[model samples]
Target: MAKYSDEFKLKVVKEYLTGKIGLKRLAKKYSIPSNTAIRTWVAAYKAYGNNGIKRKRSKEVYSVQFKVEVLHFMKQTGASYQETAIQFKMNNPRLIAKWNQKFLEEGIEGLQEKAKGRPSMSKKSKPTKQEKEMSREEQLERENELLRLEVAYLKKLKAFRENPEAFLGKHKQSLPLNSKKKDSD
Candidate 1:
C-alpha cells in the first residue's frame, strides 16, 4: 500500500468536506488507484478529526478473544471491514479482513499470536513488563500453552531415547541429518 503524508491526507479530506465534489472525483484528481481510499479517509476524518489521518507510531496488539469478538460482530452484523474497524475505534480496517481470512483458513488457532522476529539462539529470555502485568487469566492461558509444549517435548525425547533409529526414522523432519555410525571397539 502507498503511504500518503499527513498534509496530503488533510488536503484531500478538506476538499472532500467541501461537498463540491464526490469521492470518485477526488480520487481521480489525486491519481489514487481507488475511491475507496477517499471514502475511508472521509469516514476516519469525520470520526477522529486530524488524529484520524495521522499515522500510528506503535503497533496495537489485540487479544485473541478480542479478535474472536470482532469477527463474531462482523459475522453477526454483516458489516464491512471498514465499518467494523470504525465501530471498534481501530485505525486499521485491513487487519480485521486479515483476521477473518486467517479464521477461515485455520480456525480459531490461526488468530493466536505467532512469535515475531528471529528465534532466540540462547536461553529463553524473561517475559516483558507487559507480559509481567498480564491478567491472571492470560497468564494461566500462556502457562497452559507452555506446559503443553513441554510435555510434548518430553514425550518425544523419551521416544527418541528409547529407540533412536526408529524415532529418527519416524520423525525425519525433526533432525536435518542422521549422525555418522560409531566405530566398533
Candidate 2:
C-alpha cells in the first residue's frame, strides 16, 4: 500500500467529513487503491481524532490472551475487523484480521508470539558413545578426588578434637588474620 502523510490523511478525512462527497468519489479524486482505505481512515479519525490517521513508529506487542479475546469478541458479536477494533479501542483493525487468519490456519498456536531474528549458530550436537564413556570416567575421577579430600578433612578434624591446643599451635602461623584474632579472643 502507498504510504500517505499525516497531513494528506487529515486533508482527505476533512474533505470526507464535509458531507459533500462520498467515499468512492474521494478515493477516485485522491487516486487511492480502494474505498475501504478511505472508510478505514474516516472511522479511525472519528474514533481517535488526528492521532488516528498518523502512522505508528513502534510496533505494538499483543499478548496471546488478548488476541484470543479479540477473536472471541469478533466471533461472538459477528462484527467486522474494523468494528471489532473500534469496540476494543485498538488502533489497527488489519492486525485483528491477520490474527484471525492465523487462528484459522494454525489454531491457537498460530496466535502465539514467534521468536524473531537469526537462529543461533552454536547449536549443541549429541555426544557420541565414546564421548559419553569418557564423561563417565571423568565423573568417577571427580568422585574419587572428592572422597580423598573428605578423608583428609576427617583426619584433620579428628586431630583437632584430640588436642585442640596442639592443633591451634601447629596451624597458628598458617591461619588467616581473622582466624588468629578469633583464636586469641
Candidate 3:
C-alpha cells in the first residue's frame, strides 16, 4: 500500500474538482494505482474538505507544559498510576510512567518523544551503594574466617609433629626376634 501525503491529496482533490478530466484519466495522469483511489479522495474531499485528506487519527503529541502539569498534579495529589491515567484519558499507564521518570531524570527535555529503540539497561545493572557495601563486608568476613581456620589447622599440625609418638601410640607386637639374638651375642 502506498501512503499519499496531505499535499498530494489536496492537489488531486483540486484537480478532480476542476472537472477538466475523468477519474480514470486523472488516475492515469497522476500515476495513482486505480480509479477507486481517486474516487475515495474525491468523496473524502467533498465530505470533509482539506482536513479529510490528512493521515488517519493518531495520538497528539503532548506538549511540555502539559507534561509539567501532569507531573505537578501527581506530586500534589499522590494519585495512583491508574487514577492518573484515567484522569488524563491515557490508556497506557506505562506511557505516563515513562514520561514521569524521564521528567524526573532530565526535566522537560526528557518529555520529548523519541523514536522507539532498545531500552536502556543502566538502571537495572547498576548496583546501589548499600548493596556494594554489604557485599564488601561479606567478602571481608569470609576472608577473615578462612584465615582463622587455617591458623587453627596449622597449630594442630605443629603440636602433633612435636610429639609424634604421643599422638600415634606404639604397638610393639612384631619387634624382630633377630634383634634380641644380636643383643645377647
Candidate 4:
C-alpha cells in the first residue's frame, strides 16, 4: 500500500472541501488508486478536522470498555458505520461494524481480544475417554455453550424446543454475566 504523507492528504482534503470536483475526478487527477481513500479523508476531515486524516503511528488496541462505549454510542445515535468511525477517529469505518457484530453475537465478552497465533495446548485439559462419548443432550449442551453467542438467535430458539427444561434451567445461573444496558440517552 502506498503511504501518503499527511501534507498530501491535507491538500487533497482541502481540494475536496472546495467542492469543485467529485472524488473520481480528484482521484484520477491525482493518480490515486481508489476514490475510497478520498472519501475516508473527507470524512476524517469533517469529524476531527486536520487530525482525523493523519496517518496513525501504530495499530491501535482498544480496551473492552472502549469497545462497549463505542457500541453504545453508535446504537444511541443510530449512526452509520462511517459516521461512527469518523467520530472515533478510526481509519476504517468497517471496524466499528465488526465491533458491533461481535458485540451482538457474544455480548461484552465478544469485545475481548483473543490471543494471537495457535492457542496454547497446555491450557486445555484433555477430556477423559468416557467423557468423550457424551450423550446427545450433553453434546448439544456443550456445542450450544461453545457457540451460543456466535450463532444466530434462531439456533437458541431451536435449543429451547429441543429441551425446554434445559433452556430454562440453572444453566444460565452457572455462567453469570452482566447484561444490564448502559443507555446513553
The per-prediction CA RMSD against the true structure, in angstroms, equals: 20.0, 25.0, 36.2, 11.5
lDDT of 2 by residue, 14-94 (tens): 999999999999999999989998899999999999888888766566755556656765775578999888766666899
The candidate 4 region of ten consecutive residues with least summed lDDT is: 176-185
Cα lDDT tens digits, model 3, 58-149, are 55566554555456445545775545554554443556788899978986557655768797676557899998999999999966765664
- Per-candidate TM-scores read 0.64, 0.66, 0.31, 0.55
**Candidate 1 lDDT by residue in tens digits, 3-119:** 898889999999989999988899999898999888888888888888878877666667665576567557755789988887677767889999999989987668777987898
Ranking by lDDT: 2, 1, 4, 3
Predicted structure 4: clash tally: 0
Off by over 4 Å in 1: 122-185
Candidate order, TM-score descending: 2, 1, 4, 3
Using TM-score as the yardstick, the better of models 1 and 4 is 1
Q: What is the lDDT of candidate 3?
A: 0.62
Q: Which pairs clash in model 1? A: none
